[model samples]
Target chain A: GAGVSQSPSNKVTEKGKDVELRCDPISGHTALYWYRQRLGQGLEFLIYFQGNSAPDKSGLPSDRFSAERTGESVSTLTIQRTQQEDSAVYLCASSFFRGVQETQYFGPGTRLLVL
Target chain B: DQQVKQNSPSLSVQEGRISILNCDYTNSMFDYFLWYKKYPAEGPTFLISISSIKDKNEDGRFTVFLNKSAKHLSLHIVPSQPGDSAVYFCAASARVFGNEKLTFGTGTRLTIIP
Candidate 1:
C-alpha cells in the first residue's frame, strides 16, 4: 500500500456485540502500532508488532482487546463484548524501524461507535 | 499519569499571523519529539520533529522548538493559513530498550481565521 490503510472507516455496533477493526500497514515497514483516541483525548498506545510477534502488549486495556498481525503486514484488532467506552477512533501506524529515531506513517483510522 | 501535556485545548489565530502551540513533558529520557497535524476523520500527519541534540527543526511554514531544560517544546506556524487549521498533537519517545512507544498529548485545536 502507498500508506497505512484501515477498513470500516465508520462503524456502529450495539453494546455487548463484538467488532473487528483491520489495519494494513505500509509495505516494507518493519514496525506496526495500534492506538485508541477518545473524543477530546490524546492517542493512547494499545499494542505494537515488530514482525509477526508483539513484544509490548502492556497498553491493551483488558483481555477483551486483543490484536494479531501477519508477518509485518496486515493487523487486526478485536474487541469482545464492547461497551460504550469502546467508542472512539482507532489509529494504526508503521515505521521503517522499531527504534525511536524513525518517523511513523499513519493510516486514516477507523471510527468505532459502540452504542 | 499524563507524561505529556498540552495545556491549551484550543487556539485561534488570524491569517498571516504567527501561531504558537505549547507542549510539556516530565520524562527526561525522551530524546526525540514530534508534532503531528490531524484533520477531521483523518489520521495525524507528521509536521516537524526535533532531536535531543538540536534545539530547533524547521520545515517551511512549520517549526518545532525544544527546550530540554524545561522539559518543554513548542510548534510555530508562520504566516498561518486556513489550511493550517487542524488538531495538533505532541509526541515523545525515549531511546531505551523496548521503549519505542510514543506518548502523546491531548492535542490542541488550531483555528485560523481569514
Candidate 2:
C-alpha cells in the first residue's frame, strides 16, 4: 500500500513569498497531520485533522501558517510571507484514526528554503 | 522547554554489539512512548512502542523500557546491525482528549560499525 506522500520534494522561495506544500495521506486514513523540522532539531507539530472534527491549530507557530484538509483526503499547508526562519522540512503524516496508540506513517517531506 | 530530551546527540556501536539510546521527559502526563528510525532523505518509520501500564515492550531485536517514576525511557537494540545506522527519534504523547499530537525529541544519530 502506498504510504503518505508529499509533493515538490524541494522548494526555494524569496522572503515575503508564499509557499504551499501538499500532502496525500494513505487511502482510508481519517487522521492527517503536519509537522516541521528545522536544521539540527526535532519534528515540531504544526496542525492536525481528524475525520470531520475541527482541526487543531494550536501548534501553528504564527498567523502566517495554516492548513486545510477536505473530506479526509488531500491537505495543503500554506505559509504566507515566507521568512528565513520558516526554512525547514515540512512533513506530513496520516493514521487510521486519531487514537493515542495509533502509529503515524510519515511522508518523504518537502524541504523549503527561504532566502 | 523540551518535553522529550535525548541527551546524546550521536552514538557509534560495533556490529553485533548492544546499542542503547536514552531519553527523558519532563511532562509526567505522557503515557505512551515510541521510537522512530529515519535514514537520509526519508521519513521516520515506527520501530517500537511502550505503554505506561507496562515497563518494557520488545519486538524482535528492538526493546523499549520506560520508567514512569523517573520520567525516563531507553531503546535497546541487541546485536546491532550496520543497516541500523540512522537517526533515532524519541517521542511521547499524553492521552488528552482532542489532543493526540506527539511531542518529539531532538533525535540521536546512531552509527553502526561493521
lDDT of 2 by residue, A1-115 (tens): 5889998899999999999999999999888889899999999998988874546888899999988888879999999999999999999988886455788889999999999
When only chain A is evaluated, what TM-score does every model earn?
Answer: 0.96, 0.94
lDDT of 1 at B2: 97
The segments of candidate 2 whose C-alpha lies over 4 angstroms from its true place after superposition are A98-100
**Model 1 chain B poorest ten-residue lDDT run:** B93-102
Quote the B-chain TM-score, candidate 1.
0.97
TM-score, each model? 0.97, 0.97
Clashing pairs in 2: none
State the RMSD for candidate 2: 1.1
Candidate 2 positional error at A39, Å: 0.3
Task: Looking only at chain A, give the TM-score of model 1 against the true structure.
Answer: 0.96
lDDT of 1 by residue, B3-114 (tens): 9999999999999999999999999989999999999989999888899999999999989999999999999999999999999999998877475678999999999999
**CAPRI quality level assigned to candidate 2 from its DockQ score:** high
C-alpha lDDT of all candidate models, in order: 0.93, 0.91
For residues B9-71, could you state the per-residue lDDT of candidate 2 as single tens digits? 999999999999999999988888899999988989999989899999999999999989999
Say which candidate scores most in DockQ: 2
lDDT of 2 at B18: 100
